[model samples]
Target: MSKPIFERDPSDPERQKINPALKLLLELGPLLVFFFGNARGEWIAERLPALAGIGGPIFIATALFMVATVIALAVSWALTRSLPIMPLVSGIVVLVFGALTLWLQDELFIKLKPTIINSIFGLLLLGGLLIFRVSLLRYVFDSAFNIDEEGWNKLTVRWGAYFLVMAVVNEIIWRNFSTDFWVAFKVWGFTPLAIAFTMAQMPLISRHSLDEEPAE
Candidate 1:
């Protein structure tokens, strides 16, 4: 029996590879849209009129974010015939929380979405390591990285910790800051932090890389 359309066989030679730039755009585009929607919610609402029923700026942003996320996932599936696990998981949370935010007219649900998603990811990654002695990160990044088991273990630990930290940070910011500030941080602050953390791991990745040529 053939695998499901959404399940990618990474080892298959025929599997289409997405360009790195395009992949980054697909992942980041929705967040950008969310930020823009929030900043220009009045403008957008006035022009579209239908979206004004969604409520204020934050609510408008959440609705746009949800739509953009669905589009991103659909594009990924259409191009590759598979959804990336992390984004797919995030998208599900966005849809659920976004719906709750819109229907209940409460922005709190949308604010908590990141906290919930990050906590889930943190627990899954750490729990997999603790209980199964497996680095689930390996499965996620295997296509992009080739490293020893030790590297994967260390990477998993770092990422799990980082995710938990992000969850805490999200909680703090949303609780204390204005909605606009929180949205800005989510788009600008968290993204740079994640990028910096990934860059910081390059040395560890290099040390454990299986692709290194054997020294004579």
Candidate 2:
């Protein structure tokens, strides 16, 4: 079998681990790029006519969003030699939805991308837990923790529900708000909310930790 993506070298005392700080940058970097691209899209188009193909703020933003996401994913693959699951999934969605947005010249498609992605995750996590009788969350968090089966199950359920909640919130915001406001919320609002929720789970994580050494 192939080596696990998150596995650490056993004998390399000087080896570097993927720090949370860098992970945050890797994850949030593309969104920041997208916001900047959209906010400055007019100046960009005025300076570079080539970018005028995807004219207007939203279209230019969508195109640049795709580019930024692809760059982020490529950097992650280069650094780790393995794709992180969530980013991979999100990148794929960005490409597909962003393409449609550019092709159709409609901003709604890009605006609704997050709602669809989050809903799919909610279903996948919740349904997999029910059908497999095991928490699919383990695949992502296993590198960070050694929780028992029951703890894994509880965490998985919580995450699955959280995904659903996020989807609903995205739908409400994007549907009722202006595109620029939605874009700002997508970058600035959603991430902090997720971090807050994850932080709230730390006590539970510590309680369920297996008291084993982290792989390194």
Candidate 3:
């Protein structure tokens, strides 16, 4: 039997590796589709006609977002023979909340999707570290970096806190702002913040990287 996703060793040489750029594109493609679908929902609905029944711009975007997310996950599974833990979890939430949004014609469910996903991730990471003394982040990112245990602990804390903060940020944005603004922030704002935060962790990763050369 195939190993569970969380148990699979990302660093294992036997695992098929996706190109970094393609991997990123796969991850971001759905969000881009969500943004565009919302922005041009009427244009798209006019052409497709079928999507008109889905309701407004946000609802239309939610439907397209669900399809895109499924496609991304399918591609990932096809290439890697296993789903990625983080994206897989996020995709499940997208499908669930997206369905609720469509069936009820309520935008609130879709709006709350990010907040829910981020909060779950944040709590999982934090709980693992604080209660179990384990760095769960290591499993998710082990393929990307070869940091030592100490580095993993520190990275876990930072990422856990970051996820929680993002959850709160998502709540604030969707609650206070217009739908367009929320969608834009989801695509533009959240992406940049995550990228910047990841970049900022490079020094910590480098410092604890097992691949680093020994001092002369």
Candidate 4:
């Protein structure tokens, strides 16, 4: 029988250790909550008066997003006994930006969250590869894939460039688009882009598969 995700041995580096559906929920639950909260913040505030201080719909959503992120991290810690680095970093970003958005009553901070996070990821990946000669992608995805050194290097370069593009795209959308459209795009558009990008990497991944003969 497959080991339950929470019970998987830390020493094992395998994909789908956790149920994929549950993993997706834990990773994305907060974002889904944030989107819902933004769409219904006033309704929620009216029903629960304590949240009136949260200001606008987006602000209320940001506050809830912070709470949800904290919960997700807590649950991850409880289950894994160790924090996942990328999620931890992203969670920290959300809290800091979420707090600023609430304290300043300016939505710009929350709006810039994706841009900042994506840019940091992009720079870290590219800088690690180009300047430090390190492939940070391995740390993030080692469990899911095993690649040759050359493959890792190429994949790292590709992902780094993609992340930079995503960051610029976020900036453009938030700066010029409607808030509703931006929020929806964050949920729908960017996610599809990321999924597509990941899928697109399969050719390179399969070529470098440790378990299979390297493609000629």
- In candidate 2, where is summed lDDT lowest over 10 consecutive residues? 7-16
Q: In angstroms, what RMSD does candidate 4 have relative to the true structure?
A: 5.0
State model 3's lDDT. Answer: 0.90
Q: Write the per-residue lDDT of candidate 3 for residues 7-111, one digit (tens) a residue.
A: 355556666667778888999999999999999999999999999988988999999999999999999888877877788889999999999999999999999
TM-score of each: 0.92, 0.85, 0.92, 0.86
List per-prediction Cα lDDT, in the order shown.
Answer: 0.90, 0.81, 0.90, 0.84
Of the pair 2 and 4, which is ahead by lDDT? 4
Give the local distance difference test score of model 2.
Answer: 0.81
The CA lDDT at 102 in model 2 is 92
lDDT of 1 by residue, 1-216 (tens): 764665454455666667767878998999999999999999999999999988999999999999999999999889877777778889999999999999999999999999999999999899999999988786467767889889999999999999999999999999999999999999999999999999999999999998969789
Candidate 3 vs candidate 4: the lDDT winner is 3
State the lDDT of candidate 2 residue by residue for 99-182, as single tens digits. 999998988889888998888888888998899786767656654667777788889889999999999999999889888889
Query: Per-residue alpha-carbon lDDT of model 4 for 139-209, expressed as tens digits?
Result: 56665777788888999999999989999999999999998889889888988898899999999999887
Model 4 lDDT, residue 154, Cα: 92
Determine which window of 10 residues in candidate 1 has minimal summed lDDT: 3-12
Candidate 4 overall Cα lDDT vs. reference?
A: 0.84
